[model samples]
Target: MHQQLPPEQLDRLICLEARIHKKSKEEIIQEQFLQIESEKQTDENDRNKQNMDSNKKSDDLKCSQNSENSPQKLFTSQNLSPVQKKSIITKKHSQQKKKKKTKEGQQKDITQYLQYQKKQQKAKKCEQKLMEYSIQDSPFKNKSPLPSDPALEKQLKEKQNQIAISEIKIKELETHNSELRETISSLTEQQLRIQDVVKQFAIENEKLKKQQLQVQLQTNRVRLGEYVVQREKTALVDVWIDGQELREAKEQSKRLEVLKAEYENKKKNSKNKEEQEMRTLNVKLNFLIKEEQQLQETVDRLETEKNLHIKQLKRVYEEEHARFTKNNDYPLIGERYQVLSLLGKGGFSEVYKAYDLQELREVACKIHQLNSNWSDHAKQNYIRHAIRENRVHKELNHPHIVKLYDSVEIDKSSFCTVLELCDGPDLAYYIKKYKCFPEKEAKLLVGQIISAIKYLNNHKNKIIHYDLKPQNILFHLNELKISDFGLCKVLEDDNSKLQLTSQGVGTYWYLPPECFHMGDQPPNISSKVDIWSIGVIFFEMLFGQKPFGQGVSQEKILKEQIIVKSQSVTFPQKPIISNECKEFIRGCLAYNQVDRLDVHQASNHPYFQKKLN
Candidate 1:
């Protein structure tokens, strides 16, 4: 009995065979049926099931060969009808008899397929056995004895050699065929690319031809116009020459034409000359640029040398001055105070640390010198200004205020004022050392400043420290003191009236909006000017920068009205200040003097009132 393959397995095997042969499934199935029938005729004594198995193997081998030989032809073969295909595949025999001629034909057809498979297996086995025998009987080791006669051994060796030769030939043929296919594929790709490039070039060539034709057509039209113009001119000349009265006119016209030609030639020559001059000018411009660059380099070198020279001179001067002060007791002002060392210097005065002869105490002596270039009237005015400063400074007496000691004229040209010395650095030093103070510390320092300013603005002494700044606030053993009364103004009335003074008197950043006003009348200055300055100082103490125009220059500040136009003071995001503190700062930094808090009002603010509670 014959066993049939399962439908699924048959379909899978058929699909696989089709793929291996690179043919349609129908063609692979048809080949399988033919192989089965041929196997049945060849192996008549074997079971019919073995024939089916052998058919699968034969079909696989045939399909692999067919795919390698004429793959394209098999792919293009005509499709068979469903009925014809089914009849060809399903035709079965139940012990059916075959004609003698049919049996012979089937045997002949199967003989080559069976013979080729037998030859392939026989060749592989011979190759394997020969390799094993050669290794076992190598010349490098002991030789094994032959079990056969010499003639038999020679015949077996020849057959092995033939099989080896045939295998090598088959491998070489397969390698050569594969190489040819690769070369053909590569050449075909290159041909396609070349065709594409040629098509693109042909398109561009046609566009260039069209453009050339257009240019030629335009030139022909221009030539025709010129020809017409020349013909008309010649006809007019002929008419003039034919008329005898017009002969002189024709001669004049010819003369005019000759002159016009000469003028045109001259114009062309002038144009050429101008172009040549332009080229010369360009050359000169390049030379000038190089010269300018060289000059700049020279100037930079000279400036660097000058700065080095100035620094050397300053160092020498300082060394000489130090030596002079150490060796001599020369600076005995008013024949009483003995100068020790320089404390600080200012625009119009120099403060020196000195010992008082009568009191035997350390004091700061501020000296003002009369310039030799100043006239007698200027000297008198300066003397009067110094005396006024002395009077205003001597009246101040408070815990936070610097005390005045005495005033003396050192010589005919120089005057010195002595005051109590504060041995510590100014508030500006602390402000620089620490970026900013915490709210509690800043409030404590600001309270001391407010207290001092309040005393100055009292009814008995209506004085305003016009030059109030971080530099003027000194620290004496950690005690805050307000110093420097050079720019202070005195109000005569208890009403705290505004005083007119120099517009550029105090520091611009600290001064109020009213101080920068320019008109027929000078700006009114009052105690409120100090309020605006205190606001800026307090803001700087908390935020490490000024509230308005922090980094702007003084000239720009005036021109741009940075402070005058400021409608409000903005607080920094950092330092996390309270709203009460912000409100107090806003009250002091008001754009209008009338809207601003006075010294008394500012001192009573909630920011300070909280401390009192």
Candidate 2:
């Protein structure tokens, strides 16, 4: 709309957008058809029911009429119908089938429980008898014959002496029984405390069980509804097919008869009318074709003009990427340091290649959005970014990570991030230039991002790369560096802070499922959201186009596509670079987040595995 892009691209977009609109119209038509079919089905059912009622009424009337006109016939025991008996027997059979299984199961469980109880009783009785026998036999008898062997006798004597000493110690301990009882009481108190913890655990377990039960019940209800709808839809489809075939055949016969009659009865009049109509239609068709040719010429001229404008936009955008390409000549804006070019821009700030005369070195300066003085929330968030950027960079000294030079106080009035400039195109621009990047190149870039993510996550820093598109990845001297932490939230860092936000933050075409369903905004995205972004990148690398087309209203576009044709889930409209690549992309973009591979698993994927050096 702004004409920032070329006119031809815009025209193509307009045409493509029209096609999408047509698809949407078709979907509306389909919905209307479904509604009509439902109404038809309802009407048919009502008509059939009415017909049956009418037929029953007629039969009743006929029976009454016959009974009145003639003498009433006597009924006998033979009045019982065979159909009624068979139906009764069938019901009885079903009842017996169900009841017999239940009865057998109940009887088995009863017998098992009774046997278990009897075994417990027997054990108690045996234990009681054994204890009584031991009590009665104790002091008055030698329970066995004395050993005759000299060594055995000596061992026995020693054992008896040890036992006596043990008995004396036991008696002494009994004399100090109050102290022992106090110790036992302390232990018992500890045991009670442990039991209390166990009881708390049990209560928590019960609560979890209830929650699980509710979830399971809801799942069952949904599944049941889905199955019923599917079954009904299948039945209707079959009926529609049969009715369509029958109607076509009948209509063909009727048309043939009509045509035969018309040809025989009104041949001369019909011929004159047809000749007149053909002459009129030919004139109209000639006029329409002439108008269409003129419109096509106008469209072609516009296409050329639009392409020129797009080329201009691409040049401007590439100039920004080129600024990052000139790592040595970073120039800042507004002071003695003229901002040579815009390096990159994000939701928060624009990065510039700035020159510091005093330092006499090129530094990548991030111009703060606060210079314009936005809202308090904006300031706080930028402050958080500055802090996180500093802290994380200071702690993490990975070679893959872009190095932070300093957070300089410019003119004692503003803050600018001075970073070590890297001379390479970002992955987004790289892929755009190359169309679909080779597997080796893609994985090499991905591995670097993985290294950076792992470093962040491993530091117990919960700074998920909330925006992990290819554009954010800079390719510097064969090393990929991740940039832009504007959307990052510090979750499990030393701060121990929690945030719940649902604002659309990342690029829409590359959004995850959570971002899609989390409403009109991005959700309080998890690390899993990064995983989804990775999936998008994975697809982008394998295909020139994104899984969802590059469109402003792509969210809505994809939503429609998913609604009408879920099975058409695919990569770019262009042919695939590889099947393995497609599978890899698909695995990452699984609708169920749990089904997707984690970063580690993804890195080792067969498609990527070969590319890993």
Candidate 3:
């Protein structure tokens, strides 16, 4: 029989043999059919040959048996050894068994060959059907199925039913799994919500506990105050009683002295009568002496009580003052600063006199509060203005420029800028008090201002103090210090001639004509604007009033075009300002920006350069 391929090789041939050998499945199936038939034919032939051989062997064995059974053979067998005779008999039996075994094996082989032929026929028909289906519907199909036999179809149907049931079970399991996941997610969310609630409760509890503590403290303080008041009242009553007792004791002592004098006089007149009177007077004097001793002791005790009361009151006052300072007198800022008093208040900011904790010096804390009511844009502009102020002020280290110590944003709504504290009054207050300044003193002060301005303009980023005014200028130890850079402008570079976006941003009286210029396009502001402001300030110092727009509202100044139309500045007759100073002021207050003196020119002017006579 031909060697059969293993199941793996047969499956490979069925699936991939066509692709490898470039033969169709029909050709491969036909070859396999021919091969199976040849194997069957060979097997049948081999079985028939074995049967024929068995028949021949049987015939030979029958002859031998017949010969052995003959009488002559019998006499020979009897004469031979019993062992030989037994071996002969056993060989005959072995031959018969071999014949029977051959017959049985041949029958088995025939049956197996028939079964294999039947299987091959069925397989051939199935393969033919699969090839037909593949050609008809799916030529390139990898897994074309064979025609269904009844038994195989039944099994397949059962298997499909079982698979469907298993799929249903899998779907149910998936649904259950999804439900479990949803439940787990819900539980986790609940846990998170509970945690958040617990945190809120904890915070509220802490707040309530703090509030309870505060209430208890207030109650205790009230009780302590009542006790102190009662003590003070008792002390006052005791003082009054002591004073009354002291007066009564003094009267008694005076009476005793008067009686003694009377007794002496009587002794001079009548000796016996005077002796009786002297005894009475001596007894009265002894009683008065004891009463005086008791009164002195009471007085000493009263004095001690008075001293204790005074000390207690002083301590109480000190504690109240300390508590007030701790609670209300100071800003909410930590230990960094202690606000002493409000130095000044402006439209958008407040200045407080504060003691710096780290620097151990008094500072002016300018606080800007961004009101919630303000528009978002306004708040942003306010913050940007403060930032610009900090940027410009921090770079300056001039003696006349107010030193910036620290700048901090307290919160979203508050900003603080700490600056050098000027102990003396502002220039406005000084001008108001003196009505005007002497040309000599004004020269000294104005020169300092000009020098600071010169330094500012000469900086890499030219700075213009747009809002220079008497109120913004401060005196620290009688030295002029310029302050309040909120409305100041910074140029890109020294040669930058950038137009001013904020057209009107200074005190109307101090603003130059260019600042008041109204047109389609804003004017380009330079150091000349500051020079005009300096002239205005100098004119005010000498004449005690603004040259162009004194006591004029900004609205009126804009509406009337006061600064824009002014041809020249006029001086007061009573002030009698010198011509040199007047000429300097005129140069500063020139209507045209080009005609206005620059800070350097103004600084080197003969008025400032001249030595005091």
For each of the candidates, the C-alpha root-mean-square deviation to the true structure, in angstroms, is 42.1, 49.8, 24.4
Q: What would the TM-scores of all predictions be?
A: 0.47, 0.42, 0.47
Residue 261, model 3: lDDT of: 69
What does candidate 1's lDDT look like per residue over 328-394, in tens digits?
5335677567675566666677777776655656788888888788999988987887888899989
lDDT (CA) for every model shown? 0.72, 0.59, 0.72
Better of 2 and 3 by TM-score: 3
How would you encode candidate 2's per-residue C-alpha lDDT over 1-613 as one tens digit per residue? 1222343453354456458676432244344446545655775687699789979978876786677653433233236698997898799768757655654454444344445557877999778667766786565343454558999977977998799899999999887897889989999788767654554454455457546755753443332211122346447331111123233444554555555455444544546567766565555555545655565444444333333334433444555455233463333344434345556665456677655544555557776645446777877866776777666665556787777766755553356766767787677665655557766666666667777776666566666667788777787787888876656666764543334373445676666655555444434445656666776786678676676555438567555644223222475556435677667767767776567666666666788666443
What is the overall TM-score of model 3 with all chains considered together? 0.47
For residues 278-330, write the lDDT of model 3, one tens digit per residue.
68766766775676677666554544444433444444444344422346644
Query: Which pairs, if any, clash in model 3?
Result: none
Runs in model 1 with CA error above 4 Å? 1-330
User: Residue 112 in model 2: shift from native, Å?
Assistant: 99
User: Which window of ten consecutive residues has the lowest lDDT sum in model 3?
Assistant: 221-230
Candidate 3: C-alpha RMSD to true structure equals 24.4
Q: Please report the TM-score between candidate 2 and the true structure.
A: 0.42
